[model samples]
Target: MSRLSLFAPDNFPLIQPGQPLLPAIVDALTQGGQPLADNDILVLAQKIVSKSENRFIDLGDIVATDEARDYAARCLKEPRFIQAVLNESAAVVRCVPNVFIVQHKLGFTLANAGIDQSNIDPSCINEEHRELALLLPQDPDASAAALRRQIRDTLGVNVGVVISDSFGRPWRLGTTGVCIGCAGVEPIRDQRGQKDLYGRTLQVTMPAIGDEMAAAACLLMGEASEGRPIAVLRGLEVIEADLPATALLRAGNEDLFR
Candidate 1:
């Protein structure tokens, strides 16, 4: 049996717009007394990354079009907010009261294009940025790669990075954490053609490892007010790989639901 250790910083500082995430992570790790270890997987909440990237939207700057207004009327949401979602989305998947699902520009089919209204820094919510909405990073995979590179270049230790976000699943009641971006991590472990204990060969035995880790990290990084946005997972068997989270997504030919 293999054992995995997870560590979280109790005092991981609250991130602000334009904050350098590396320094904050380093400080948290220092305070926690867990220096960077080889093969360690760093799981990060996507909100902090967006915060560091200053990916907040000022509602006042959004101009709603006819389509946005129509969707807002049906969803009972603010027109500007809907417009912002439309701007972030590639296409609308569904629109209903309290639910506006769309395919994000980054190809994630999630509610509101994964644009979150909760947990936004209140200080940035002012007259200029009315009812601030936090957006996903422009390029999450690139963000993860950059962070991984920075960790290696800065600390001389190679670690995996996974950027996580909450996602609602079909026929599922609540949201769970999923990997939106990753670097130096194996997104999927394809077990096809592998033999089982009974010597039976597996055909489609792929598991999303990155998403599994992200879900575990979210257990510590709670949905509401847990304040732990970063966690370290050590002892994963394949923590050092050159794969991104996009590898987990099903292509058009492989997608059965579409």
Candidate 2:
């Protein structure tokens, strides 16, 4: 029998900069009878990854440029934070009165490159204690690899790790977490040549299992919830010794949408 369980941490303390997330997760899992089994996937929220990597921005210290001020006025965002977002974005793809779409350097089409201000501390508004907002990690793949190595070395267990962030789908209303980085698990499984129950040939069948797991985890790890930055997904079939999320991305020439 295959089963899936979502683990949400209970009243966990705020994760400070330089704090290790894997150890915190290990402690939580240990308290919960170590729910991770072989082939299990650990779906992690990218906010925590960014926090650990010191990817936060202080809104008080920024000097908004003319373009940034214009963007801030249009987007209704803090001028400093909007400037930072602009600096991080490769190009501004779309812009409206309060909505701006940007293509990040990492080739992700997202709103403001996922810079958020909803969950941060509002009290910290002074120069010394500026409000913090998360920036996307410079290299999400490397972050996943380092975390995977730490987990293997510390827990003596082999499992898959996924670093995920909330992203809006094209022509979709809401946002869901998608796998930006992954390790030790196949991100996609191609079943194009397989036969269905009706004996019909299947074509172009590929499952984005990594993104699926990320969305599932994000359900429990709510955008506003305190703690619960990690979730464990069990009972997934393992087909590779080393798997990376890049495999899920289609080449520009191969993509029909492109």
Candidate 3:
């Protein structure tokens, strides 16, 4: 690609449960004078997609089991919150005071199963609920595909979609955006047996393109207080790849970190 561009609308609205996302995105883009175009990829924060999908849980609604209570005691968190995490997790990786990491049912090993409490609007939350938490979308890959389809149907433009979430690596200090779901994008680009600039044969050079794109767009969508939840990445040539984000996950046998 000759050049890359990233654009985020300055006035992205605070998303609410069950809200439709496409119209808001289009309105924001049109207002910002950066209308959507063919081949443009949209990188979205997972929170917005979850909110739109109404993937919310009331801490008051949870009834902690004995196992969940034990985990809560160790993590120094609420039993109900721990119970919610336990319900969402397929396996518990580790638990410590104020930190509980688990492998989500979606096969991602992340902290608290990607359930978060930050950036939720209290005004939008029902008064009956004591504390509300947002969970990741049920099927993020399907959500991405649905979004891509919506754009194509409504605007008559083919585009790519990426649902990104913040993740912390065990060896890394801070968290960065990662591709949890994607459509019309290549999750991994295999460069094995390809020749380098000096005509040297290359091996073991597969790049996680989806994660790279998500991370690059996240530089515009800040983690906190940045209202900009969506970003447009232009000039990427990976469109129509139609690969799922699961391709980014390493197979169990190839996972040397664990």
Candidate 4:
């Protein structure tokens, strides 16, 4: 690719559950005079997608198990929140006071199982349900694929879609965006057998293109209330294959840090 560009349309109404997100995206693009182009990549914040899919939980509805309560006490967090995290995790990875990390059911090593309570409209939440949290979509790959198809049908343009979330690494001081779901793009680009500039054979050089793209788009969509949930990445190379974000997960056997 010669050049890359990323921009978020500045106008969009608050997203709601069960709403057709594609049509609204198209509308916002048109309203901002920025129509979809071929090979354009649409990066969406995971919060909006989860909200649209109605992946919400009321803390009052949770019945914390003994294990959850114990972890909550150790982590100095609420038992209901700990229960939610346990429900979404496959295994507990790390824990400390005010910090709890787990291997998400989807294979991502995420903090608090990616449960979030920020940027949600208070009106949509029930008054009694003060501890409402939004969970990640059940299947982000499927969500991305369905959204891509809808975009294609609406605008007749075959574009890529990436569902991104912010994540903090073990040693990293700050958080950056990561692709939890992607469609119409290669999540990992394998270049193990490729030759270097000096004609030397390369080994173990696979790049996470989806994560890179998501991080680039996140520059425009800030962590705080930027009000820009969708970003369009232009001039990206796209592959017409089912490359899901699951490919980015490191196998348990390959994880040396653990």
lDDT of 4 by residue, 1-258 (tens): 398788898756778866768878888888888888889999999999998998988888999999999999999999989999999999998888999999999999989999998987765866676677899999999999999998888779989999999999988788999999999998889999999999999998999999999999899988897888999998876776687999999999999887
Q: Is candidate 1 or candidate 2 better by lDDT?
A: 1
| lDDT per residue as tens, model 1, 47-94 | 999999999888878899999999999999999999999999888989
How much RMSD separates candidate 4 from the native structure? Answer: 1.2
| Residue 148 in candidate 4, Cα distance off native in Å | 0.4
TM values, all candidates: 0.96, 0.88, 0.97, 0.97
Sort by lDDT, best first: 3, 4, 1, 2
Please estimate how well model 4 matches the true structure, expressed as its whole-model Cα lDDT. 0.90
Q: Which ten residues in a row have the lowest lDDT in candidate 1?
A: 121-130
Score each candidate by Cα lDDT.
Answer: 0.89, 0.77, 0.92, 0.90
- Highest lDDT against the true fold, candidate: 3
- Off-target runs (Cα >4 Å) in candidate 1 are 125-127
Which residue segments of model 2 deviate by more than 4 Å? 122-127, 241-243, 250-258
- Candidate 3's TM-score reads 0.97
lDDT of 1 at 240: 63
